[model samples]
Target: MSDPRTPRPTRNEAPQWQSEDGSLILAKCEDCGEPHYYPRVICPFCSSDNLSWITCSGRGRIYSVSVFRRAEPPYALAYVTLDEGIKMMTNIVDCDLDAIRIDDPVAVVFKDRNGIPTPMFAPVQG
Candidate 1:
């Protein structure tokens, strides 16, 4: 189910990071040999236009997190440090909000928001 309040992604948005099927698309800089999120044409580190799109491992650890228990349905937001060395802001879902902690292992999951596949994370199941 999609949330009505969630904003729809614009077609003009550059570097579309997530595919409709829910795969994560990441941009890597061949020049600096670094990977970054919020996929951009130019590398943030080396300022090079040599970027390539690649499928990411979609695995990361929570670097920082905050749980908004006061919200109507509650939600957790965090910066996840991905295995590819990129940190992205995303929501943590499908688990107990109170159990979320920094450094917890997580994996990517997608939730449909207005027909767009939005990337989120959840605690890696054992």
Candidate 2:
């Protein structure tokens, strides 16, 4: 089976939602007013079809993390809890591996992947 963490192949067609600045696009339910990640046509919370896209604040805190020490350059996989109450699994980058901690404030950043913008997180710089 393919690892779920692996990103899907880039689509040939233009995305329905595109961000020029690499900001997150969130799906919000018009009925319940709850925002969710991994935008879906139907709201996961209320099963409402009235969903709309919104730009995310891109600020969150690390909920959990695992460092892959065996990887050639080392990397971290983490679940981040966004300020809007959505949690997403993402890679943490641009910081010392030994210093990462749960609840560390993080901000979204994009990495270029075969011409597609992939979202990742890094410790917020002061």
Candidate 3:
């Protein structure tokens, strides 16, 4: 048996599938200077392979959310629009449902699930 005081290891922190380094999902188009997500081999808009990955600020707002009472008994699925103009679907953690609302500020947090780094969002502190 292991020490009870030690926190249980999660999948993402299991030393096998942890991200090599934090990287923002980014893609740049030649026709425009804006960056996009859902990484692709070529830019969807300009058909250019001049895409480059960049680090994200990891800040965003709650675009939408839904409380899952039946599926997970107090779980929430939310859409967060990143500060960089990209939106991602993630879970909201570290706060209560009553406290979450549309347009609420949030910060990115990495959760380890079976050695996979899953992105989660927490309410931003003032």
Candidate 4:
């Protein structure tokens, strides 16, 4: 069972979705006009193969949240529904762990992951 919270292995053949600048590229369903997180060959909603890759605004509202205190560096994880209407599993950083809550506005930021830049969300300032 693969964890949805973890990014897929960086494959040379993987779809060019995430960029080094922190903005996320996602698939937009041509049929239903719904944007989805986590790159895929087909739309999960309508089962349509017609999808377009586009950069999201990288801002979203926290739909849910969880805090893990056992790790070396405790962290907050969440399901954020991007302004584009896609919910993605991501870690929340740069803010106090106890301060994050559902409906908190967040912005995406790039963090180092295995020497590669990965997208992580943080509480939006002001």
Candidate 5:
């Protein structure tokens, strides 16, 4: 049986939605200098079509987190503050829940989810 969590391979084309692997590409408005995620045809901030995708550093720190004890298989969810000053909600992986803490440094790790690369974070090794 095929694993249900396998990510589909991307074809030789640009993705309609942003890649899930923490590629860290976002649209910045050329007009108002605002950064937006979930790539759009127009800037939500100033309604400008003058936008460009830019890659960002994937390093971030845990802004807040919660351990799920009684919900849907129980996993750690967190708000990670990216180096670009954007706070993104994501799952913390590749580490023990006991090791997760607020302000702990994390680096991006791409995980395949049903054939789509998803952005996750792990503890920054020293």
Candidate 6:
């Protein structure tokens, strides 16, 4: 387990995938062709030690959402399934909670979260 004082490493923390623009990165299993949300040294599905990182297309569909009405900005949390087949927990911003719907197309956007470049999603434009 990681210490609570230590911050979780983001995609930018790795030497290779330095997503300066806060793009989403997923771990791909070289052995099983499975993709996972968090960076890992081994493929969880196949138990293979070989894994590679790939930048997501920044496109996805909203699987579900939960809105927090008490938040200052009325935070809406979402489970988004990237086109790469990996699902991630992220925030839906720049729109009203009522505007979000299941399977809605979204694009990744970078936002500063407590000094970290966190990824958020917004409705895709035509």
Query: RMSD of model 6, in Å?
Result: 4.1
Total clashes, candidate 5? 7
lDDT of each model, Cα atoms only? Answer: 0.81, 0.80, 0.70, 0.79, 0.75, 0.77
| TM-score to native of every candidate shown | 0.84, 0.84, 0.73, 0.82, 0.75, 0.82
Q: What tens digits encode model 5's per-residue C-alpha lDDT throughout 7-120?
A: 343331135234655565656789999876556678878999898777778889999999887966678899999888878788898888888999999988877665556777
Candidate 3: residue 120 lDDT (0-100): 78
Better of 2 and 4 by TM-score: 2
**TM-score (C-alpha, index-matched) for candidate 2:** 0.84
Candidate 5 deviant stretches above 4 angstroms: 1-22, 71-73
lDDT for model 3, on a 0 to 1 scale?
0.70
Q: Write the per-residue lDDT of candidate 4 for residues 65-114, one digit (tens) a residue.
A: 99999976788878999888888888999999988889989998878665
Look at candidate 2 and tell me the lDDT of residue 95.
95
Tens-digit lDDT string for candidate 2 (13-103): 1242346777777778899999887766688889998977778898899999999999866899999999888999889999998999999
Order candidates by TM-score, high to low.
2, 1, 4, 6, 5, 3
lDDT of 6 by residue, 1-126 (tens): 543432356443352234686677777888898878666676779899788777779899999999999966588899999888778888899997888898999998877654556678998855
lDDT of 4: 0.79
Model 3 lDDT tens row, 8-48: 43432233123356433445565556566655667767787
Clashing pairs in 1: none
**Model 3 off-target regions past 4 Å?**
1-25
Instruction: Please give the lDDT score at residue 37 for candidate 6.
Output: 66
Assess the local accuracy of residue 91 in candidate 4 as a C-alpha lDDT between 0 and 100. 92
- What number of clashing residue pairs does each candidate have, in the order they appear? 0, 0, 6, 0, 7, 0
* Residue pairs of candidate 4 with colliding backbone atoms: none
